[model samples]
Target: MIMRPGHQQLLLPVNPFFLWASLIVALLLNMVPLGRAAWLPDLLALAIVFWSVHQPARIGIGAAFVFGLLMDVHQTALLGQHALSYTTLGFFAIMVHRRLLWYPLVSQALQVLPLFAISHVIEVAIRLVGGGIFPGWQFLIAPVIEATLWPLASLLLLAPQRRAPEPDANRPL
Candidate 1:
């Protein structure tokens, strides 16, 4: 493949096992007993958005819904609360996936900030509708933190695919 300035090296195909494993790890991170602080980043949501943007075909609204439901069950929140928010997040991510990839990671993070904010708004709105008390202004921090984590997430998640098939001194990928 011919290289263009600013174009990233071509990535190898994503491994299915690695993909699922990343999601599971994110879920486990969420499951940690952190007392559900409003400012805490939603690891599962971050991972979902990451994968939805990078590999839309493999991680779409359906997968988001499933993970959301699991989160609801774990948190004992209203049924479908996380589902609705995560589905919205995944949908928006997929919608912008192609265009988002054209920019540098920092720009991509900026683009995704709104998606994370919207997801949080959806969750808070649902909670409010269900008579839950206001979580205060601190809730606003979650989206920003999630956006800040975007560049790190992209580098980490794509690491496996970025490796050369076989290290060779003679050939540069």
Candidate 2:
């Protein structure tokens, strides 16, 4: 049975269940006990990029807010600390979303790096104001790593599908 073009475009084989599942996996990756710097993956950022570029309507600032809250809660860092920063970051991401969606992998990584830095900056400002100790330049390292990983992350995460277009009655079949 052939699917209509609209139906084909609209169909979601996995629904949101799969999307949330991927996010959960990202959460796990974030919460993993990785003591070393080399092994860390910017799981949450990567997932946000994936969904932002591919499914902005489904995942946006709101989702980022919730996820940030979750990160704050699970990591026991700060309550609204990450949430505010993440929401602000998400706003910019959404603002540049059209460019992000069309950008080549390397370009996307380059652009997103600064955004990752911006997000981190918000947190750092919060920490600084709250009398958190100077974490030194090491704190900058994670977003650098996170930004560097975007190309690979996007490829692995998006997994684009270009299915054949379905029939339309006006065109010859």
Candidate 3:
């Protein structure tokens, strides 16, 4: 389980604010309209990866499943589709999270890009197998954007806390 230094005692569930906020952001981004491009920014994918790496127990596969359901509902897409993809992605992220933590920015970005891509690929493959034209290359742009945002994402998740070490107490009763 991932944990923040300041949030050591925070072994409980993920905050509702973070969960819903990520969903709202993903939903809003999904609402964007584009005439020439059929691209989505994969904001929710990044959020799931972020929280999974930084707070695994609080935001694990179950969280991914729930969020995927919400996303599918919001987009009116096929049911159990995003949920299945996200659940699989979440499992992979958790399994390899330790190695991901040891990697630097470029390597980490490289590692993460594929996870995001996997979700899209799974979705696309399912649609194709169901009898549909393959989505264009623009469908691939979101993971690149998501990978580029890793630096900003780290700051967003880590820079807010300023925990100071407490001195040991040995007072006699």
Leading candidate by TM-score: 1
Residue-wise C-alpha lDDT for candidate 3, range 1-173, written one tens digit per residue:
76533343333344567655765676567556543254756767787887788677777999889888887787666776789888888888898888787666677888988988888888778667767677798888877888888767765655433222342455321
Q: Tell me the whole-model lDDT of each prediction, alpha carbons only.
A: 0.94, 0.72, 0.73
TM-score of each model, in listed order: 0.95, 0.78, 0.75
Instruction: Between candidates 1 and 3, name the one with more favorable TM-score.
Output: 1
**By lDDT, is 1 or 3 better?**
1
Per-residue lDDT of candidate 1, residues 58-173 (tens digit): 99999999999999999999999999999999999999998898888899889999999999999999999999989998999999999999999999999999989997997674
Candidate 1: misplaced stretches above 4 Å?
A: 1-5, 169-173
**Candidate order by decreasing lDDT:** 1, 3, 2
Off by over 4 Å in 3: 1-24, 31-37, 162-173
lDDT of 2 by residue, 1-173 (tens): 75433352433333477677788899888888775342354578677766766677888889889998998898676687778877877777778887675556677888888888877778778878877766677778877788888877765654433222464777543
* Residue-level lDDT for 58 in candidate 1: 99
A best-first ranking of the candidates according to their TM-score comes to: 1, 2, 3
